[model samples]
Every structure is written in C-alpha cells, then in structure tokens.
Target: MVIILIRTVKYNLSKLRDLYLHTTCLATLANMAPHVHRLSAYASQRLVSLFYMLSRKYNKLTEQMDDKVGKGGSVEHDSLAKDMSAELHIYADFLRIVLEILNAILTYALPRNPEVVYAIMHRQEVFQPFKNHPRFSELIENIYMVLDFFNSRMDAQTQNGEWSVEKVLQFIISNCRSWRGEGMKMFNQLHFSYEQESHPEEFFTPYIWRLTLSHCGLSFDHNAVNLFTVDLPAEQLDNAGEEHDEPRQNGR
Candidate 1:
C-alpha cells in the first residue's frame, strides 16, 4: 500500500506541472492582444490629425487666393481712373490751345471789317467759346465796345456837323450795306433810336452801352464815361495788341 501511494503522488505532480504551463501561455497571449489593439488605435488617431492639418492648410491657401484676387481688382480700378484723368487733362489742354488760336485771329481780323466787328458785338453765340475764360472774354468785349463807340461818334458828327443828312446816310449805307450779305439776318434789327421822353442818363446806364459811349469820348454826364474807363489801364490794351501780334510772328 505504501508503494501505491508513491505512484499516485508522482502522477498528481505531472498533472500539476502541465496545468501551470497552460496558464502561463494563455496569460501571455491575453497581454499581447491588448498591446496590439493599443498600437492600432494610436496609428488611427495620428492619421486623423494629419488629415485635419492638410485640410487647414488647404483653407489657408484658398483665403490667400481670394485676397490676391481682391487686390488685383483694386489695381485694375486705379489704373482705369489714372487713364481717365490723363485723358481729361489732354482734352483740357487741347481746348485751351483752340481758344488761344481763335482769340488771335479775331483780334487781328475784326478791326479791318466793321461788319465783322458788329457781328462779334451783337452775336453772343460767336463769343460763347471765350465766355468762360476771363482774359479772352474781356479782350473780346472791349474790342466790340471800341468799334461800336467809334461808329456812334461818326454818326453823331454827321448828324450835328456841316455834312448833309443825305450825304451822311449815303456814306453809312455804302459802308454798312456789305454787312447785310452776312448770314446774320439780325443786322438790320440793330438801330439807334432816341425816345422822345427818355432821359440821357437812363439810356447809358447799362454797362455795355456805357462802355461803348465811353470809348467815343461822349459824355452823358461828367462821371458817366469815367465809371467804366477809369479801371481800364493803358497796359491792358498794349497787352492785347502784343498777344494779337504773336500769331503773325509764328507765320500762323
């Protein structure tokens, strides 16, 4: 019976060793499975972060492109405005040159033709181009006033002096008849008529009419001619004559 007990103890020891080896192998496999799952989760998170970074970079690039487009549009608008400004400056210079040329021509040519002088004085449309320009308008108006005053003086002399009414009328008819051929049908409309009851002071009150009489040395009153003539210096007349002579010097 003692021999049987020893054999049974040895069999139990071998079964216990087999059970311990199986438990160790199963524990190692369970730990390795959890480590593998952790590594996979970490790799997936890194991939998601990389995709997010790439999307953010793409959005930044798109915003930069939009800013560049806006800047380009502004540049184009500025270029257009500069071009328009340059064009306007060129046009203004051209108009100034034209006005200068017209002024030169009218100054020299009008004095030679009384009818042309009359047309210039009465026709506001003919002088419209110079109306905006102070210097040119003043010169034109002064020339018109001078011519009218000279003609009126000649008329007054013929009316009051030894010259017969028929002879004076004949001279005027001969000299002024050429003016009717001009396109202005209103040439006949301009006539000096004295009202039976009108005061001399009342007739010369208008600035234009006053200036005309002033140039002829006629006096409605002591201060009538002085009112307009006092301010006009001899230098202004000289300057006008000099300006008129420039075109002739240039052979224009």
Candidate 2:
C-alpha cells in the first residue's frame, strides 16, 4: 500500500509539471483576468512574500558563514553549511520552476495575459534583488526582459499624460503581437525536464515527513528528522558499500 501510494504521488506530480509548463497555466491566468485587479494584487503579494523569505534566509545564512570564517571558526562554518544545503537546494528548485512558469506566460500568452504582466510589474521591486545575485541571476533573465519591456511602455504612458492601469491594459491589448509565428519564439533558453534522479528518497523522505506532521497538526521535532539523523547516515552507508565493492570488482 505504501509503495502504491508513493508511485501514485510521483505519477500525479509528473502530470502536474507537464500541465504547468504547457498552456494550462496560461489559459487559467487569462480566464482570471476579468477580475484582474484582485488577481494581480493576490499574485503580487504571494510572490513578494516568497521572494522576501528566500532573500532573508539566504542572506542570513551566508552572512553567518562569512562571519564565522572571518573569525577563524571552522566547526560553526561546517555546521551552518550542512544546515543550509538541503533546504536551499529545495528552495532554489522551487524558484526555478516559478521563474519558468512566469517566463512561459510572458513568452507565449503575452499581450493577451495582461494580468500576469500587471502582477509582475506590481511587485517588480522584489525581483530586483535576485536579478544580480550570483546564484539566482540566470534564473531571472527572462523575467527581467519582460519587466524592461513593460516598464519602458509605462514610462512612455506617464510622459504622455496621466496614466492608469486601464490605459496600460489597453496598450498591451493594442500593441502586442499574438502568440504565433515570430511571437512564438521563446525569449528564454530554459526548458526543465521533470524526471527522477538517483536516490530521490534522500530529498523526499524528510519533506514528506514534515508535510505529514503539518497536515496532522503535529509539531516537527528538528532532532527527530534532520540531515544528520537521516541523510548523513544513508550517505555514509553508501560510501562504505562502494568501498566494499571495490575489492570484489578488482578480482573479476
């Protein structure tokens, strides 16, 4: 039963990833545009919240590590590095998927999907911090392009006279190209594949355990489920197994 449930979850996740990358997400965003004001507000708020968390945590961790290293500290540096590795990898993947989704809408559903543009523009400031961060800079290029394009248009409108959201939407509807021919060309080179990597359990096990605890209204005991308790032991065993295999392989 457990095995079956895990397989089912993986299969559904695969389908979801496919649907998100295709037109389903874009179509949904367009359909929601009738209430675009509310939609944009909600979307921008959520995006800003996520970016804020990532920026705060990332900066806090890096600064701590730098401070420790500057003071000739070794044990604390290794401990902080271990603490950050898995969680940050998960966050980075999530941010990549999000940026890809945004790029898809902006690239293929553009001009028609003005709501997405509106939401992004409303929270453009949150995105700027990541634009040049060494780790996240590449993930944000397509988004930056879209921001630049719309911002330039908004500037022109402001110069002309008193500009408003209505005028911005009207301009997008009038001036933008359809999602076809030259318009179909993608501005971004990123196309992510959803596939299983080796030892995927190393990432999923802790995550699922936490999800289960949260949904069950239980507290998460950090010591009960941590990298040191789970991932490190498994990795050490794998390394030992590989070492054990070497002599047998050499005898063949």
Q: Which pairs of residues collide in model 2?
A: none
Per-residue lDDT tens digits for candidate 2, residues 163-205, read 5778766665555553232423354434433466899998788
State the lDDT of candidate 1 residue by residue for 117-236, as single tens digits: 333333334444445464345444543444455466566563545665455434444555333222211111111233355575654565666566668775454334554544445776
Global Cα lDDT for candidate 1 = 0.39
TM-score for candidate 1, residues paired by index: 0.23
**Count of backbone clashes for each model?**
0, 0
Model 2's C-alpha root-mean-square deviation from the true structure amounts to: 14.9
Go through the candidates in order and give each one's C-alpha lDDT: 0.39, 0.55
RMSD values, in order shown: 57.1, 14.9
Give the Å error, residue 104, model 2.
Answer: 2.0
Pairs of residues at least 3 apart in sequence or in different chains that clash in candidate 1: none
